[model samples]
Target: MTERVEVRQNVLKENDRIAGELRRGLAERATLCLNLISSPGAGKTSILEGTLEALGGTPLRVAVLTGDIQTERDADRLKRYGFPALQITTGGTCHLDASMVQRAMASLPSPDLDLLLVENVGNLVCPASYDLGEDAKVVVLSVTEGDDKPLKYPGIFRRARLMLLHKIDLLPHTRFSRDAAVADARRVNPEIEVLETSCVSEPGLGAFVRWIEQRLAEKRQAGRPARD
Candidate 1:
């Protein structure tokens, strides 16, 4: 019991310590950052690509920091979207730490950027335990992955400020239950802002973008830079 308690305390304390420093460093540039987390193949990258496309003409100057264990492939893929992007290869780590983000800040193009999307290593479990000093955490899930995902990963679900359900376009051919997924997610986090989207069908995308715009406006209203 003592060991477990110590571990928990250390994790929280260490996370807050690093997160505070991160907040200070980012404040110099006033970059609105969003940390995206989900399991492998949960459409985190796709959603990001879609977002870049969605906001291509918007006033927000967006850049991306993509995390992967093995390759720089995700970053390479985002280049075609015609935006500045950096890939942070975690070198087999399952999650991103505050130090990794802090280091990337020096190399990433700033002053011209209003927002940074940090695509975290794809793992629903460990990512929740680390705070990368993001304005908000966006947890993504796909209907193809089944409805019980939120229940199975309650920690990530509960920690998310927003939950996104992707791949709903393929729902007709599959056994996925949209209502059940949303219901299950609400059970874990009743206050979590949820959005359903399909890159293929492009349904509910306007709402998603509107949500982002609203968030950015809210940040500005709070006097924290309206770029997240």
Candidate 2:
């Protein structure tokens, strides 16, 4: 058991080392990297689709690196918006690690993008533990899922900078309590920003886009050289 624990720690240390390098490299380019995490069928791709459509024909150079256990389907869906998109098939791996992202970055059309959204493999458990060198981690929770998820998966909620309460269009059909969900999330992470979104009705979709634009602007500002 001691040997097993030691191996796990060593693996995480190496992962963090690589993640640090990736973070610095991205920072130098003023790229805002966001790691999106959620369970399977939680609408990560759908939100990306809406975001890509909203940001299309704009000057913002955006790209996506979506991960999955086996298929290239998510990447395919995002590419329809005419932005660069890549699929990292993990081959049964539960999460995307820094090394996987580093290798995949080499294949992008250009590394100078303003926004790099990484849709991590859809497992709220393991993906929360792996750092892909993102500026922020966004957790997506669909109303179709349990409202108790924030309490159940405190690790992800605690570390997330934002929680997108997606699929709000179906709230009338479901028993999901929006107030309970937000309150519970705050209990774990008081600073976690919550956005109620629905790709179908498009409520809060504009706000989501504005949030990204704001973050991207902030990233660019931070990367600027200080004037004497």
Candidate 3:
């Protein structure tokens, strides 16, 4: 058991080293990397679809790297938006590591893209432990899910910079309480920014899009050299 624990520690150490390199490389290129994590049926893909529609014809370039256990359906769906999209099939892996994301970066249509969104495998526990070198880790939770999700999955909620309350259009049909959800999330991570979103009615999609745009701008600004 001790040997196994040591091995796992070594593996995570190596992963973090690689993730550091990836973070620097992305910063050098002025790319805003967002790591999206959520449970199954949380509407991650649908939110991306809505975001793409809102960002249409904008000067900012966007790409997606979606991970799944078996199918390429998420990547295929995002491709319809006319941006580079790569599907990372982890086979049986429960999460996407830094090495996987580093490899997927090469498959993007252009390295000059302003934004890269990595839709991690639909597992809250494992994905939260793996850093993909993203500028921010966003957790998506559907209203159809329970309000106690943040309490149950405290690790992801604490690690995430933002939490998106997805499928709010179904709130009237579900027993989920937004206040309870936010309060629970704050219990774990008080600084976490929460956004209520609905792909159908798009209640807060614009604010979410603006958040991305702001991050992109900040990344670009940070990468620029100081003028004399």
Candidate 4:
């Protein structure tokens, strides 16, 4: 058990090194990188689809890097919105690490972008352990997934800056308790911001886009040199 723990620590140290490099590069470019994580069928892709569509007419330059175990379907769905979208097939890996993201960044059409959204593999556990040098970690939770997820997967909730409670349109049918979910997430992370969203009915989709825009603006402002 001691040897195994040491090996895991060594691996994480290496990942953190690479992530630090990635973070510096993004900061230099003033890019707001967001790592989005969730369970399968939690509406991560759907939310990205809507976000990309909403930002299409805006002047903000945006790109996406989506990860999956096999198919490139998520990237395909995002590309139609006229933004640069790439797929990182992780083979059988449960999560995307900094090395994979570093390699994927090289293939982007442009190095300069205002927002870089990385849709991590659909797993809350392993993904939370790996840092991809994102400005923030955003977790998506669907009403169909039950309200106990925040309590069950505390690691992700604790680290995430925002939680998008998705599939709100089906709230009338599902046994999901919005109040309970929010309470549990806040219990895990007092600073975690929650947004109720639905890709079908488009409830909080506008607020989601505005949130990204605001983050982008803040990143750019921070990167600007201070006046004497």
Number of the top candidate by lDDT?
4
TM-score for candidate 2, residues paired by index: 0.94
TM-score of 4: 0.95
Q: Model 1 over residues 95-125: C-alpha lDDT tens digits? A: 9988888777778666456677899999999
- Please write out the lDDT profile of model 2 over residues 46-71, one tens digit for every residue: 99999999899799899999999999
All candidates' lDDT scores?
0.83, 0.93, 0.90, 0.95
Winner on lDDT (2 vs 4):
4
Candidate 3's residue-wise lDDT over 36-68, tens digit each? 999988988888888887777897788989999
Name the lDDT value of residue 126 in candidate 3.
98
Q: Model 4: residues >4 Å from true position, as ranges?
A: 1-11, 202-204
Ranking by TM-score: 4, 2, 3, 1
Which sections of candidate 3 miss by over 4 Å?
A: 1-11
Task: Return the clash pairs for model 3, or none.
Answer: none
TM-score of each model, paired residue for residue: 0.89, 0.94, 0.93, 0.95
Full candidate order by lDDT, most accurate first: 4, 2, 3, 1
Name the better of 1 and 4 by TM-score.
4
